[model samples]
Structure formats: structure tokens, C-alpha cells
Target: MHKKETNLSHSKLANNMMNYINKNIDTDINIDAIAVEYGLSKFHFHRIFKEQIGKNIYETIKSIRLQKASNLLITNKYSTITEIASMCGYSSQTSFIRAFKNRFEQTPTLWRNGGYKEYSNNILHNSISSDVSHTSFSHLEAKIIKTKRKKLYYIRHQGYNKELSKVWQKMMAWVYTNNIENYEQIAIYHDNPIITLQEDCHYIACVKVDDKTKLTNTNLPYFEIEEHLCAAFEVEGIYGDILKFIQWVYHYWLPSSGFETTTFPSFSVFEKNHFLNDDGIFKVIYYVPVRYV
Candidate 1:
């Protein structure tokens, strides 16, 4: 096959992987099976997935699980935190609390009571039991473009499952103990290049800290998302499957979009309530660099 054909083939396979993730969002989805189904070894799939989506299988799963848990926290009339956590594949309440706080900056109790003001009411009220097995996303397109720069404060983190919790705990504890600032208006920026760049990505979760706040090593490496041309695309369905969709965009969409690549690494912008549902209709504006075509 020609180069273009080969790229297209991979895009199709990646799309299949996304569909499978959404279909099995509520169940114990297996990445190994997906690897096998695509005639790829686990390692190969991991590499390809990261190269395409900027994240790996583990991150994808966590994103899906958290979104489902969020949906349940607001929508399910009778679900408890324990039930929600267990159903979402968390091993314990402590674990669930840690993950929940990491993603949303609030405990399950607070989130439940607050009712999520940033997301749509539909997102908070959406059904959680629908199966994604029959769903389709074969008509999506990826486009490249230029965008303005975005300034953000970032915190770097590294570890295994829910390990970022420790970092967050330390950060928040420090914030409170020292009277640093409020986390309510801040969005944690995940800046770790590994997590931001490839499979097994780490969190550089950051909140917009006050400018006058004193800093330590735990507080920085804060930077800006530079202004440049970007390649933007949408990844449908569960966020866990986001990597493969990203792979489709980078490996296939860019080449076909008639856009020359630039140096800046891509980043995703989350819109309102974008992370609140399992099979949610979220639009992630991925920014990639573009040069003259």
C-alpha cells in the first residue's frame, strides 16, 4: 500500500478502538484485546496510541472512569459514592476520593452537593446505563490551524495510579497552611511532558496561583501555551479512547489536511461539562502547529 493508504488503514483501526472503548465504558474494558484485534502487540499499540493521541491506555481508562463517576454523582437518583466508585472500577473509597479530587478539585460529597455549575444540566442529568456497543463515529474529521497563545500555571507530577493525589494533597495542604490561594477558580494544568507527550503521561496539574505568592520547587516550571498555528480535531465518545482518536488525527488527518506541521506540541482545551459524561458529546479543541502548506 502507498503511504497515504497505510495512514488511512491506521486511522480506521484507531477509530475501531475508540468505538470499542465507548461500547465498553461501563464494563471492564480490556486494552489487550484491543491490541490483539488490531494485530498489534500491547507495546506497539501503546506507542502508536501515544504518538497519535498524546496519552496512553491507562490515562484513557481513568478519564472514562472519572467521567462516568461524575455522571453518576449528579444523575443517579440513588447511587452512593461507594457504589459509584466500585462500578467505575475503583478498588476502594479512599482511592475513589483521591481520583475524584484530582480530576475535579472536590470530594465526592462536595461535588454531589454542589451539582456542578460549570457543566450543562443535561450532562448532569444524562442517563448512565446506555450501551455504546452499537454507536458509530466514522464520519469525524481532523483539521489543522493557528491559534492565539494561552498563559497558564502548571505543576509537574509523576507516579503510578492516583499518585498525583499526593502531589495535590501536598499542594492544597500547603496552600491552606500558608494561606496561599483558593483552588475554586483554578484549573490544574497537566504539564508533565511524558503524560502530555505520549503513553503513560504524567500530570502537571496546575491551578492559577496568585502572582504574589511565593514559590518553591513544588510550585513551578509554570509556563505559557505559545501562540501558533494548531491542528484541531474532535475526539468523540469516552475520553479513555481519546488517545487512538488523537493518533488518527496526527498520523492520518494532518497529512490529508494539507497543513504543514510546526514545532509546538499539541494541547487539548476542555469546554464546559466536557468531562462529565461517559459517552458524552464533548468537543476537545486540540492545537497543533502549522507551517506553510
Candidate 2:
């Protein structure tokens, strides 16, 4: 294979590994088993993963697990510390508390009981302006809906900033090149920007695809957006507006709504993409996967 093809192959494998880990986060994940599943020797798989992802496999898994735990701590207040630990795959609450404190510098109980605000405020100080408050979307009503599963061709992006325009540009180029039409543009927010550092947020730029679509030559990965029960809200906003809206959904509306968020990441279906437009405005239907508390 050409050098570019080899790189693409590595990226595809890394994406597969990430998806697998996330889906099975609550279960025991064996690295050797993953290597076997990918038909590669353990050493080879680790090398490829580190080279492409800039972090060793173990580090990636630990980071993802902790991030999931952090999200759960804030979103699922009713679940006890022991339950949250079990949900995040820790063998025991003692072990989970040790790891969580090592990573977050706070115990699970403190993080759940408002310590996260301090952590978030420290990270978001320079990124999000103080004036951008969740009040912007306070009046918007959320509807409960069931969404069908969707197939997406996506490019993973790391940051949630204006630089995302480049990712959207690349996605559009891929769509036009593949002759894909009648597709909806969607973005999956894998991290809560309020809690995660802005530069480290996981964002996916995706285009919804159907059975008829064909990719003659492309290396982009495909992800199936599982069917979800969600609280859907229509939002129209500028750069900071969507961030504020997400904050509102998680902090304001969710706790009192009699629902707990699911482990699935929240996503938005774009009616107009702010990144691609000159005016920097967006129209989207934001979906937060949820279930009754």
C-alpha cells in the first residue's frame, strides 16, 4: 500500500478501537483481545495506535473512562458514587475513587456535589466569555422524541472552535466527490465543553448517508448513530449561543425534567452550519439522549 493508504488504514483502526472501547466502557476491556479482534499482533496494534493517536492505548482508555465518569457525575445526580463507579467499569468503588481522584484531583462525591464548577471555571475562563450565559436558551422548550438510527461518514475533530470550518470543508469535499446528495449534516459533541477544556473537546463532523450511497474511493470511517430516546430542542444562535444552549440543557433543564441522560453523547442536526457561513449563525435541532430517572 502507498504511504497515504497505510496512514488511512491506521486511522480507521484507531477509530474502530475508540468506538469499541466507548460502547463497552462498562465492561472489562482486554487489550490483547482487542488486538486479536483486529487481527494484529498486540505490539503492532499498540504501535499503530500510538503513532496515529499520539497517545498509548492504555492512556487513551483511561482518559475516555474518566471523562465518561465526569459526565455521569454531573448529569446523573440520583446515582450514588458506588453505582457511578460500577457504571464506568471500575472493579470496586475504592479503586474507582483512587483513579478518579488521581485524574480529577477530587473525590467522586465532591465532583458530584458542585466541585466540578471550580474545575470547569478554571478551564473555561479564557475560552468562554462570562457574558455568555445559559439564560439565552432558558425559555426554549424541549420535546421528548425517539430518533431512528443513522449511518454517518464522519471526520473526527479535536477542538470546538472556529477552526472546525476546515473539518466541515473537508466533509463537504468528500460528499461532493462521492456524489452523495440528500444528506443531512450532523455534529456529535463527545464532550461537555463546560467541563472539558475547549481545546480538548471531541467533535465529529458528519454527513448522514443512506443505503444507496456509494464511496468509490474514500478512507473516512462510518459510525452508526444508535436509535435514542432524547429531549430535543430547536436552537438558533451564533458562535457562543450553541455552547450556552448545551449548558442550559445539561445544567438547567435536565435535573428538573424527571429524566437522566444516557451514556450516549448528545448530537445536533444542522439546518445551517455556523462554521461554514459568513454570518456565523446556526440553526440546529439539538438532541440529548435520555431516559426516565
Candidate 3:
């Protein structure tokens, strides 16, 4: 194979491994099983995954499990703290709570009760705007179309403190396994309007579900999309890097584009077949609600 083809094959392998790990969060997954799934030797898989994803495979599993447990706690009215802890692979309730608190800066109960606050005070949160010199707007073409309302299975992520990688893995895994795979557009909607330029900005990881009525069967949280006017911007390469594009839109695009920003929290849209774009290159479609002032 040519060098580029070899590179693509490796990328595909890495993505497949990620998806497999996500799908089996509830199962007894170890390094050997995961490495073998991708046809890579254990040592090589460990090294490659770490270099590519910036985390070892074991760390990825643990992080994802914790995130799923946290989601189950806040969104499910029927779930108790103990049950949530056990489901996420934690052996003891105290250990679960400690890990949860360390990640979210609030207890599970506080998060469930809505005691956690979204990141506010933009200037305070982002003090280094002067350091970034890329104020020149990327002349992105805008296309407007009315989309039908979508039923979403969503869990509110409370507190601006936890890593969302695990939460994302679990949510996507559930969606992929369930019959709701048809509704493939995934989104993370934040209740907090302010973008603090961090991964922990309080938000909801959501997938369009069959109906809000079936949300109970999946053991996941749920919400429905309300119709609204949205301004969309597509950013290529690593959705985690959306803060910079958001900064550009809020500070530069909105003002010059003759569009007024809404107070509502914007959402990031993940389209199906996005992996096919530029050969599994990551991208994010940021949806900012807009209106004429």
C-alpha cells in the first residue's frame, strides 16, 4: 500500500477501536481484547492509542464509565445514587461519589438537584483573548433551511468540572446499539449561554431518538428540540477545538454578519457520515440561534 493509504488504514483502525470500547462500556473489556479487535499487537495498540488519543485505552474505559454513571445520576428520575454507582463499574458507593465530586466539583445529589451552575462571566473565564491574533473572519458561506423538530435522548451535564469523553462514548454507544440508529444527528446543547472556552462547559450530549416516550426504555435522559432559527458554522478538525471558532463567531461574525446572538445556549451538531468527511477527519457544526436586532 502507498504511504497515504497506510495512514488512512491506521486511522480507520483507531476509530474502530474507539467505537468498540464505547459499545462495551458495561462489559469486561481489557487491553488484550481491545488490541486484538483491531488486529494490532497489545503493545502496539497501547502505544498507538496513547499517542493518537492522548490517553491510554484503560484510562479511556474508566473515564467513559464514570461519565456514563454521572449522566445516569442527573437524568434518570428512577435511578438512586447507589444504583448509578454500581452500573458504572464502581465497586463502592463512596468511591463513586468521591470520583464524581473530584470530576464535577459537586456531589451527585447536588448535580441532580440543579445546584450546579453553568459557566458564566465570559471575560473572567476567557482572559487571554488578546493572545490570539486570528481575528480575521473565515468567509464561510451560509445556507439556511428549515429542519423538522427532532426527538432527542439527552442528559443534562451539570457543573463545569468533568471531562465529557466518557459521557460521549456511553451516549453514542447506547444510540448505536438501540434501534434509534436512524436518528444519527448528534448534538451537545448547553443551558449556560456563556462559552467559557473549556471542555467542562455545562452541556447536554444528545442524539435524536425515536420518541421522547421511549426514553425510559433506554435508561437514558431525554429532551425534544424546539423549533428555532439557527445560524450554522462548520469548523474542520477536532470539535474540542471549537472554542476558537466560537470566539470568532461571537466576537467577529455576529457583529459584522448583521445577526444578533440569542441569550440561549448554542449547540454543536455532529452529522452522520461525518467520519467519511476528508477521511475520518473530525469536524463540528456549531448552531447559534440568531435573530435580527
Candidate 4:
């Protein structure tokens, strides 16, 4: 197998492990069980997971649990912190508060009452939730739009914050080799990075092709981004700012938008905005699947 093929194979296993963990977050997440399920020795599985995703399994699971706890806190739907902690996999409320305070510099109650926003005005500075911020997307006009299905050839990645630049570089090489460097670029996030550990989130970077384009004789897989009625919000900024923008959209925008979501997950549609001083900024349109209430 070629180098890319090897990466793809490892990527798939890492993704599977994440999927399983997500499905069972409320339970004891056993790495040994994951190793046996994958038919790899525990040692080998641990090493491969770190190599492929750049984070240890324990760290990934902890991150996922913390993110869930924080999101629940922000939603304030749970009646008490104790219940929230248990649902997030902490057996003891005291232990959960200790862990939460250690990570966020605030207790669960404080985070629920907007202390998190004050401390993490900049989302990047926070350690508690992968998806957190007080950043405003008020500048955004997120509204419903219907889109036609798109055909694309894409590459999938699973890992803690997989380097976007590396993804673009390698994808560009493939596109350029195929003589389609000028094609439109798009990305799909199957899991929200804010809610999901960066190492565990799944994403696909795609090169757009017309319906008539043939995928034969190439190993790159092709699929359609299903058409849907969506609430779309576009933001222009550096990468970190883009993440904060997303957090704002989900944390503030969605719950009060008087709309319900559909089956498809939200995704970021990408386009280059400006390139100057060896720096490239981007314009990304984040779309959430929605239906009118």
C-alpha cells in the first residue's frame, strides 16, 4: 500500500474508536476494549491512536466528557450540577466539580451563570470545553437556504486539530496532479470540534467536480453532500476567530432561532478570502440543517 493508503487506513480506525466512545460517553470508556475490538494489541493500539490523532485515548475521552458537561451547563437544561456531572460520566459530583474547576477555573454553577464567558472571552484561551466562547456572531445573518446536492471527491481525517494547512497542501497536490487545482474547495465537519475532541472529530476536505466528472482509475472516493434546507452563516477571519464564530453560532444562535434541525449535520463550506504577506485568510460559510417550526 502507498503512504496515503496507510494514513487513510489508520484514520479510519481512529475514527471508529471515536465513534464508539461517543456512543458510550455515559459509561466507563475502556481503551482495552477498543483495542480488542480493533484486533490490535493494547500497546500497539495506544501507540497508533496517539500517532494518528496526536492525543492519547484518555485525554480524548476526558475532553469529550468535559465538552459535554460544559455544553449542558450552558444550556442550563439540567436541574442540578450533580445530575449533569453524572450524565457526563463522573461518578461523584464533588469529583466532577474538582475536575471542572481545574479545567475551566470555575465550578459548574459559575459556568452556567456566564463566568465562563468572562474568563474565556477568547475561546482559544479556554481549556474546559472544546466548544466554548463568548464571541459574538451577531454580525452574522444566518438564514434558511435550500441547496442542490453537490458531487465531490474528498479525503477524510480524524485527529486532534488535524493541521488544515497540511490538508490543503496534500489535497492541492492531488488536485494539481489531476489538473483540477482551479476547482472549488469545500469541507464537511461530521462532528462539531467545539463539542467533540479535536482528535476525535471527523472531517472531509473536498474538491468539487461537476456531476459529469468521472472518478474511475483514481483511489479518491466520491460522494454527494445531500441537498437540504439549511441555516447558513458566513464569517471571514483567521482560523481561531473562525472557531469562535462557530461556537457563537451554536451556543447562542441555534437555541433561540425558533427552528428545529434536520438529520444532516452542519458543515463549513470554505473559500479563500485574501492572501497577503505570506498569510492567507478565509471566508467560510457555516451551514446548519434546519426546518421551520
Q: Pick the candidate with the highest lDDT.
A: 2
Off by over 4 Å in 1: 118-293
TM-score of 4: 0.63
Deviation in angstroms for 188 in model 2?
A: 0.7
Candidate 2's C-alpha runs over 4 A off are 128-135
In model 4, the clashing pairs are 131-194, 159-199, 160-198, 160-199
Measured against the true structure, the TM-scores of the candidates, in listed sequence, are 0.39, 0.95, 0.47, 0.63
- Comparison by lDDT, 1 against 3, better one: 3
Q: Model 4, which residues run further than 4 Å from truth?
A: 1-8, 19-30, 75-98, 122-139, 144-163, 176-184, 188-230, 237-241, 254-266, 271-281, 288-293
Query: Least accurate stretch of 10 residues (summed lDDT) in model 4?
Result: 124-133
Report lDDT (CA) for all predictions: 0.52, 0.84, 0.57, 0.67
In the range 69-152, model 3's lDDT, one tens digit per residue, is 544443444557887676666778898789878766788888667533342234324534323334343767544444457666
Q: Candidate 2 lDDT, tens digit per residue, 1-293?
A: 99988989999998888778777888888999879988999999999988877789888778777887887888887888788777778889999999999999999889888888788777656676423644467778989999998988899888788789999999999888888878999999988887777777889899997778767756789878688999999989788777767777887688778888866889999999988999988899999999886
Candidate 1 per-residue lDDT over residues 183-230, each given as its tens digit:
321222222221122223434444445556665533233444456766
**Model 2 clashing residue pairs (backbone):** none
Clashes of each: 15, 0, 1, 4
The superposed Cα distance between candidate 2 and the true structure at residue 63, in angstroms, equals 1.3
lDDT of 4 by residue, 26-64 (tens): 777778976898889999898878887788899877876
Q: Which candidate tops TM-score?
A: 2
Which portions of model 3 miss their true places by more than 4 Å? Answer: 1-137, 158-162, 189-200, 211-216, 272-281
Q: What is the full ranking by lDDT, best candidate first?
A: 2, 4, 3, 1
